[model samples]
Every structure is written in structure tokens, then in C-alpha cells.
Target: MGAAEHRQSPVGVRGAVAARSVAVHIAVLVDEVAFLLRPRDAGWVIDGTVGMGGHAEQLLEGSRDDVRLLGLDVDPAALAQAAERLRPFGDRVTLARANFRDVRTTAARHGIEHAQSVLLDLGVSSWQLEGSGRGFSFQLDESLDMRLDPSLPETAAGLANRLSESDLARILAEYGEERFARRIARAIVRRRPLGTTSELVAVVRSAVPRAAWPRRLHVATRTFQALRMAVNDEPGALRQALPEAAELLAPGGRLGVIAFHSGEDRIVKQTFRSLDPRRFAAVEPSPLTPGDDEVRENPRARSARLRVLERLP
Candidate 1:
């Protein structure tokens, strides 16, 4: 069992003392889950990407006592955090460390083959962005490690530095939709010893037009996104996961997905369309975007788009 599972509850005086020492960890887990899942349904729900349990907390809050949840994530760190945050609900919650692609398997493991509502927040967690020591942000010069699960062997740096220029270009084009993929790939090859995020960022800057710098975020933003997706097989994962989620949902079950980029959002949009309308229907012709006030409070949510679909009888 992890520290989170073993930790005492904050119900007693000892729990109070422990709280002072571990306050930051506790606070983050609570705060994160609160922001991710917006639960309005009064039935079993699944948080397919329960990163740090941010959305899970919100879902639990919006639900009645009978409305249970099955939370899943590939990251063990995220799972540990979730375990703690949802502990109050006890047996009412089931937490698992696994990719969302196995939605059916995950649900079955939790004795939940079907759910009335499913929410997938596909963005990397703030914990992963800030403290994972993996090179996620260009702002950090850390080692280029973007694997969602730390147990994974491949790292972003290995992909960026190892793949052939042509292959690299293709990844950027397909995954990042980057226009300067060829230039970026060629530049990366020339700078073969790329190790840190900043180093890669500098190379990308050299490859793109100087005028494009900062105006559209970092020039290397797309390149980094491409590498992360390829390393993690995220797009492929989504293709598999969405359909699995659709299959596992009960009649009248609703599935909601929050995608952070156009590539991801496109996949969700198309997948929802491909599902038979006789059996399932899109809840909205368009996805929902974060309001201006929400964006002001949480800039990371600016790119989010939420799409909900309902399974037919």
C-alpha cells in the first residue's frame, strides 16, 4: 500500500499533526480533482483520466450518496493522490492505475461495467507539468522526460534525438499539426546532443521565423507536443479509449471528454460522429469551452473543450 492509503484520516488530533507536515500534498490532491470533473448526473460515473483526482472530487461533490465513481489514471503518483482525496467516500470510490484505453477492463475491475456518466480530461496534470522533473515545459531546462507513466522506458529526449529527420517531421505534422516540421526536424538533427527543454527550444527557434516567436507561444511548443504524443502513443490511445468508453456506457449513459488541443478535440469530435446515432447521440453539436472567468483563474484550461454524448436505449 502507498503512503496515501496508510495515512491516517484528518478526523483526530494525530491526523491534525500529520496534516501540518503533509499539507501541501493533501491540498493539491483536493484542489486538482475539484477542477477536473464537473459531475451533474445522479448515477455511476467514471473519471477516465483522473489525474491527481481534481475532477474526481468535483464529480463526487455533484453526486448523491448512491452515485459511485471509478477513477483511472496511468500515473502511479496521480493514483496515489486520488486515493487520498477520495478516501472520504471510502468504498463508494474505486481507484485504478491504468490507461483509459482499457475503459471496459478498468470498469469491470471496479465492478462497474457501465456508467451513467464518463468524464475524460485529457490534459497533462499540473503536478506532471511542474514537479515530474520530466521536460514538459520549455520554461524548464529539465531532462526531456514526458512519459505519462514513469515505468515506461521511452523518454521524449530519446525520441527527439533518435528519430530520423523525415520520421520526426512526420510526427510533428501529424501530432502537432506544425507547419515547420521539416525545418524543425532538420534543426534537431543538427543539434543531436539535445538533452534539456531549453536546448530543444533554442533549436526550434532557429528553425522558425523570428517574427513567430512568443506571438503563438514558443516556436518549439508544437515540436514538444509531437514528441510527447508519439512517446506516449496518446492519439492512438484516445482512438481506442473513446470507443471503449462508448461501448461500456449503459443506455442513457452520458460520456464527456475534455480535450486540450485541436488534434485531440478532432479525434473526440469524429469518434462521436462515427458512433451510430440509433444507439448513441451527441449531446451537443459543438463542445463546450471554458468561460472567460474560468480561463482567467486557470490559464491551463484555455484550450479545453468538453463534448458530451449519450448512449441510446
Candidate 2:
């Protein structure tokens, strides 16, 4: 669909031109992110997961002077959309096709020593979940290719077909936090060579008892999540990126992250707490969640958790 056709809600766009060109990807906790990062005085700002440049554009517009922004994302389509939306900013913004895990190398390649602020919005964008034909959502009947970056060697289909029942169980149990992982894994192994999201959903439904189906969540949700996380090595990438981001921040500069799941939030909490107390302090003792108004407007924002920390002098 064209960008104009994708308008669901108007976000933080300042001009009519940008509002028209940019798709409707409602950035979760935009005000909270801006408050924590406060790039108005920062010379350089980094958006580690600049999905559609919603947050990046807001930061640039909110800034006072020439604040250069470095935006990184693994998906080429997302980068293209971001480029189009942010074209008005001219040379003030730089877009890179890379994962957030490579933040250090990307910064060095761009000759950036340190950044005054960094933002990581870890949740998958609405565009990817709803529009991308790469099978990120169980509601879609697309191929089971959940690689956020198409260039990635592994796909969800490969993981489902190749892994042993026990290994698959471990992935579902650990990554997905599903209680009936073993039964689901066994069912998946028996239904080998599943190529599409519909097939996987069917297998999961058959394995899980009718009474055990969650009230709010789909039975196939955990299985799909585990497979996607395994294919992308999401947790490992986050672990690598956190330390690098902490080290790359200028003194008093802040890093803000928005996580959708518990596993991701746990990692963010632990990593931020592990930083030397003398040099780092949590901006908020507890993670921030979306208010009732935001959740009512965008259901996806309901599970988002925002965390911020600052590097002290």
C-alpha cells in the first residue's frame, strides 16, 4: 500500500508534507522518549532502531540547533521509508542499513566519537507486523520467513523443520515462556516441513487443548515469537548492543529503551543496574508503561515498557 493509504493516526510530524509521506506508525511513548533523551542541546543523537524514523524526526524537530542524527535499521524497506520521510532534514540526518548490535562499528564508520543521546525502540513496528509479507503475524497466511533482515541466513521455516523436538521445546520454553512447549514442539516435529504461518498455527492449535487456549492471546503466538527470536538472535544482539551503547554515550548523556516483552525488559534492567553506580543512574526506578489513552488508541503500545539511564561525569 502507498504511504498515503497507510494513515491510521497522525503522530509527531510537524509539517503537512511529512505527515502525508510518512506512514502511520504510532511511535509509543513519544513524549516520554523525548523527555528522557532531550536532544535539544546534544550535538549528536543516535536512534539504534529507527524503524520508520518517527522518533528520529521528532527528536530533530524538537532540537534547537544542527543536531546530527544517526539512524540504523536492518530492514531495507523501513530504511527507504525513513529516508523519504526525513529527506526534509537534509544532511542533518544519516541513515544506515545495519542492526543495532553493530552500533559501535557504524558510529566509527561515520567518524562519530560519542553521542549525547541514544534511543532504542525494541518493539516491532506496526508496518512490519501488519503490512510486511514476511510472516511476522499469525493472522497472515504468508511464508514462514520471519527474518527482519531478508539477507539473514536462517528463516523461521528452517528453524521449525530442522530443530529437534527437545531443542524446539527449549526454545519455546525459554524464549516464549510457554508452559506447554514440549507438547507443541512434538506436534511441530510431527508436522514437519511446515512452510506457511497458517500451517504452523494449525499445528499449534491441534497440540494445545481447547480449554488451555489463552483468553487474550492466541495459541500460536508463543511459538511464532520463539521462532522469530531464534531466527534473528534478538536477545544476543541486545546483549551485545547494550554495553556498546553505554560506553558510547557522552557524560550526562542518556540512553532510552522501549521493550515489549519480559525477556527483553529483564535484560535491560539487569544491564542498566550492572553499570557502575558512580557513573550511571536510572532516570526512573521503575519502567514506564503506556497510559490508558495511549493503549486505547494503539493496542500495540499496551505492552511497551520504557526505561532510561544516564552516564554521570
Candidate 3:
């Protein structure tokens, strides 16, 4: 079991300590999200992927005392930290261990049928990348288990070691958008039973030519991202969640999505554009990105794209 699960209470002292240590994991584009959502006018707010409660805490602080929020996440570790971080809000804050794809039913079960604003920060949190020990980062030497939800049956190790070269290549190419997907898949196939992040990283390094490596990003970044997305079925989850969120939006309600990968952004773009123009409107011609200063402080925010949709009153 993970360290966070061992604690008796998520809002207890130990979880509080863990929350404090991860203060560096900034929630990307907080100001922009707050501006679009307008917490002051909100009655029910749902942060569909409330990692570490950064956005949730800010919304509570910025809104009226009665404005309640229902926070959902697949990551138990993140939810625990969020519970600790949002403890001061008392009963106004309600959290559930759930995937964003299940937002419609989860919200109903919690007695929230519709919300004035919903925010889905689809990027995996910095805490998950740096500290979760879940093999989300290639820089980490942890085991090759990238399942964000422990209940997930497949692991990165299972996909890498078990799949055929053609199948693995397709996953790399489609999910990660890796140019050297076939080469990487071939390398992985030759090196079977890979069990650690380092092992997979080594195989990727050997597959791509030295000169072909990306100058700005790590050689294994895309590979790790693709594996994580595949193991978690991120694309499928996003497709399911976006429509459900739109359905639960009240008139004049705003739904915001933060996407880090091109594939993720594409899905968001298409879904938002496909909404009925008479009822729902794309708030902007394009997605909003982090300001230069925000990106400077957190390099991970460099690729973040936020798209918003609002129901017409």
C-alpha cells in the first residue's frame, strides 16, 4: 500500500504534514480558472480532477461561505492531500474517490445534480510526477506501475512486457505521439520482463538515435506519458467526462478543461466545438495558456492549454 493510505484520516496530522511537503506542486492556471468560474456567483462548484485541492481551496477562499464544492479524483494519494489542504473549509467541502468520467452519477449520488461551474485540470499533478513513487516519471527509479488508480488492472510494466511490437508501437505513436515509436517498441520487445522505470528509460535511449533526441524535452518523457495514458485510458476517460460535464451544467454555467498533451487538447477542442451553438458557446477562439511568468516558475506548466465552454442563458 502507498504511504498516504496508511494514515487513519486524510484530514489528520500525518496527512497535513504530507500536504505541506507538496506545496511546490502548483495548480496550473489558477487565476485564469477563478476568473472564468466566478466563484462569488456560484452555488455548486465541482472540481472534477481536484489534485491536491489547490484550485478547490482557492475557490472556497474566493467564494461565499455557503458555496459548496464536490471534489473528485481517481488518485487516493492526491485526494488525501486535498482533504488535508481543504480541511479548514469544514463541511462546505465534500470529496469523493472517483474518476472524472463518472462525474454525472457521482455528483447526483452526492445530491448535486447541476453545478454553476466545473473545472477539469486534466494534467497529472506535479506531486504525482515527483513524489507518488508510482512510476509516472522517467526521472524516478521506481517500479513500472503507472496506474493512477490502484484499482486499475493493467500496469505500465504489463503493457510494456506483454504487448507485441506492433501493438506497443501503435500505443506509443497514438498516445505519446512519439516519432520513434516503432524503434522504441522494437527495443521494448527485445528487452522483455522490464520491471522498472530505469529499465524502460534505458530501452528508449537505445532505440532513438543520439542526434534525434528532442532538445527541450527528455528522451523518455513522451514514452512515460504514453504508457501512463494507456494504462489509465486517459483519452477514453476525457471523452466520457466532457459530455457528462456539459450535460450537468446549469444555464450560464462554465466548464473549463486544462490539457497538457496535444492529443488531450485535440479531444477538448473537438468536444467543445461540437456543442450546440444555440445552447453552449466556446468562450474563446482558442485555449488559454500560462503567462510567461507562470511558466518560468513551473516549467511543467509550459505545455498547459485551457479551454472553456459556457451555457447560454
- Top-lDDT candidate index: 3
Clashing pairs in 2: none
Superposition error at 303 for model 1 (Å): 1.3
lDDT (10s digit) by residue, model 2, range 1-313 = 3212212222331232222332343598876666567564537899999988889988787775668999999999999999998999999999999999999889989999888888999888878987989999999999999999999998999999999999999999988999899999999999999999999999999999999999989888888888988999999999999989988888777788999889999999999999899888887788888766667778889889988877776
Task: Between candidates 1 and 2, name the one with more favorable TM-score.
Answer: 2
Which regions in candidate 1 have their CA more than 4 angstroms from the true location? 1-43
Counted clashes in each candidate structure: 7, 0, 0
- For candidate 1, write residues 23-122 as lDDT tens digits: 2332222322332223344457888888777667766765668778888898998888889888888887888888898888878876776776777878
Compared with the true structure, model 3 gives a TM-score of 0.91
Candidate with more favorable, higher lDDT: 1 or 3: 3
TM-score winner between candidates 1 and 3: 3
Q: Residue by residue across 1-313, what tens digits does model 3's lDDT show?
A: 2211211231232223223322343588776666667455537899999889998987777777878999999988889999999999999999999999999999999988878889999888877888989899988899999999989988999989888999999999999999999999999999888999999999999999999999999999999999999999999999999999998887778899999999999999999888888888877778888766677788889999988887777
Candidate 1 has which clashing residue pairs, if any? 32-54, 33-53, 33-54, 33-55, 34-54, 36-55, 37-55
Candidate 2: count of backbone clashes, pairs at least 3 residues apart or interchain = 0
Q: Give the TM-score comparing model 1 with the true structure, all chains together.
A: 0.85
Q: Rank the candidates by lDDT, best first.
A: 3, 2, 1
* Residue 205 miss distance in model 1 (angstroms): 1.6
